[model samples]
Target: MEFKGAMGGIYRLTEWITRLAATNLLWVLCSSPFMFCLILKLLVMNQNLANESLQMNWAMAILAPLTLFPATSAMFTVVRKWVMGDTDTGVFRTFFKGYKENYKQSLIGGIFYTLLFVIMYVDYTVYMTQLSNLQIVGVIMLILIIILLVSMFNFFSMVAHYHMSIGQIMKNAVLLTLIRPFRVFSTMLGSAVVIFIGVKYPVLFLFFIGSVVAWFAFFNFYGTFLKMQDQMEKMKQKDEEQESVEDKKSDNLQK
Candidate 1:
């Protein structure tokens, strides 16, 4: 029996808050090593230790493929259920289940993305600073980096939603980013807003940033996927209708 009063509203609001907070907390906990390294890098930067900061950056890059990527994919999985209207799904059970199931693909994806990002960033720096005449190349690299960043968001969503190989997922993620500019920009804007707020209010990072962003990103990605499916269905129906017309004409001619 559903309660019909302010009490019900309050109960739902509290439950929703708890779900987001708990999921975010679990993500942070599972990816603690990466977080620790990030924090260390920030501290080093504040101290103006350029060499130590660079070391921390490498450490984060290495540790991220192992910890952050898988954990993030798992978080996306949890949020995917909620987006698909399974609000009562158990957060802990769903999160770890996603992590275990998607670990290999996520790890492979993480390594590839990490390496690509590092190489592009280094190239971007070199072209901009060392080879000043090739600034256009640096701009192109920057664009690719942005595209990659947005595609990475879609990567997590695809991991949660699709049962494709890593290669297929990566190909589609990049294709979707390039072809669906509206969706790509919308997801990027939403995530950037959430991240900006999360950064400004550090406390939110502990309980909302990661999970909320994952939910929003996956929500947008799923919307794009549904639209594509609808288009494919329409095309298939058109083909069948054309074939039916041809078959009827041939039968009439034969008669």
Candidate 2:
């Protein structure tokens, strides 16, 4: 039975909180090994075990493509449903369904992104540190790195929402990031806020951060996707009108 008045408002709010927390928990569980390595890396850093810290970093990198990326894509899938008004869907069923469908693509894309980040970071470090005269080059690299990070956000959103090949998704994600500056910055800003909150309240990661960020990212992505679709439709209609005008001209000439 549905509650009336304030009870209904509380019920709805509680329900959404439950959904977000549950999905975030599932994400953490799925990516547990990577998270473990990440935490261990932090501990190692605290102890000043430089060698072990480096080793843990490598371990995390290896596990990221295998676990974190697929889990994150699945999380994005769940949040995409919520953003698209399918809030009543089964969390477990939707999450795993997205995992199974998106695993290979997410893994491949993850590898590409991981390698790209490593290379760019190295370049940024060298230019900014060892080659002081090329600090300007490092600044450009830093900007590119940020763009890639934002593009990765778009990548997950696209992966969860679009049924395209990974190549096409990557191409479109980068294009969208570059072409739609406002949305790109909006996503980045929202994500930064989420990250900041999560860092402040580390416990939030256990229950809210991942899913919350995924929801906001896809919410932004879907809005942009709809606008792009509308623009494409208008362009197609304009082309059809032009074709019709040309046909009329041809008929007039034949007469």
By lDDT, who's the top model here? 1
Backbone clashes in model 2, listed as residue pairs: none
Per-candidate Cα lDDT values, in order, are 0.94, 0.93
Query: What is every candidate's alpha-carbon RMSD to the true fold?
Result: 1.5, 1.8
* Per-residue accuracy of model 2 over 80-168 as CA lDDT, tens digit each: 98988988999999999999999999999999988888889999999999999999999999999999989988999999988999999
- Write down the worst ten-residue block by lDDT for model 2: 1-10
**TM-scores for every candidate against the unseen true structure:** 0.97, 0.94
* Shift in Å, residue 219, candidate 2: 0.5
Cα RMSD of predicted structure 2: 1.8
Cα misplacement distance, residue 215 of candidate 2 (Å): 0.4
119 Cα displacement, candidate 2 (Å):
1.1
